[model samples]
Target: MTFETDHLGFLLNPLDWQPAWAEQSAEQLDIALEAQDLAIIESLRNFYFEFDLSPPMRPLVKHIKNNFGADIGNSIWLMQRYGESPARTLALLSGLPKPKNCL
Candidate 1:
């Protein structure tokens, strides 16, 4: 459970990521990951694999909308589920590098 993370708490080596690590990370952030959250994490991982970088909010929302539909992909839902910074929270949970524009 003691994995290397950056100062921002993102995984230092994305290759080290595992589902259990995400659960642990979510716990540290006081997030209780639901099945929907896990699905979004998988989608984020897919996005990273395709683009080679974590997405900022707009793209994250768009991507989620594409994959999960508008009902669950909007900013309000994301904020409700992951707090003020969904992109940052999701990037950490998905074990991807933080989105360059997240902060």
Candidate 2:
């Protein structure tokens, strides 16, 4: 199916997404994403913009670490917060394409 591309060229479904969608998605997952989590998702969006692809786990962690610092970038921490598949959660909430190797 054809999908609209975000500025970064990632497929997006804007109709199902809004700024609040991040928090809402987290709620559905039975998790709570605080400001830090939102910041990480924003960072992921930015990463896609720069690199034109969603990040896999390692790169996602590294990007957040470099941009937002270790306090929010550790993969284990992210997995704990977002579940075992953080890249999928991040992309779902951010309205971006599923990251490579996410499945």
Candidate 3:
């Protein structure tokens, strides 16, 4: 499928995002792009569709701990841990940059 460019040279996907205001650190950073063994694009889209905002790593951690029975490692290395979470992964999928001050 070809991503036809708009008159302003931007892609118009259903995410309702804009290229000029793109919050992503890299254009090629898709959640499904990494960890080939684990692909969750469909899930990400579903979650995004349900919630207008992407869940940050903090809430994601709590959600994961309670729901998935797992913690995102210890809190001492929060930046490191949150950065590696699926929420961050989903953020990447949504063209959003890493949480401001994540590192």
**Best candidate according to lDDT:** 1
Model 1: lowest-lDDT 10 consecutive positions: 1-10
Query: What would the per-residue lDDT of candidate 3 be over residues 8-103, giving only the tens digit for each residue?
Result: 333345355433223232244331233421223344345556765455666645544444344332333334432455455445444433334332
Q: Please list the C-alpha lDDT of all candidates, in the order they appear.
A: 0.92, 0.74, 0.41
Name the candidate, 1 or 2, with the larger lDDT value.
1
Global local distance difference test of model 1: 0.92
TM-score of each: 0.96, 0.77, 0.39
Q: Name the candidate, 1 or 3, with the larger lDDT value.
A: 1
Best to worst by TM-score, what's the order?
1, 2, 3
RMSD of 1: 0.8
lDDT of 2 by residue, 17-38 (tens): 5666676656767877778777
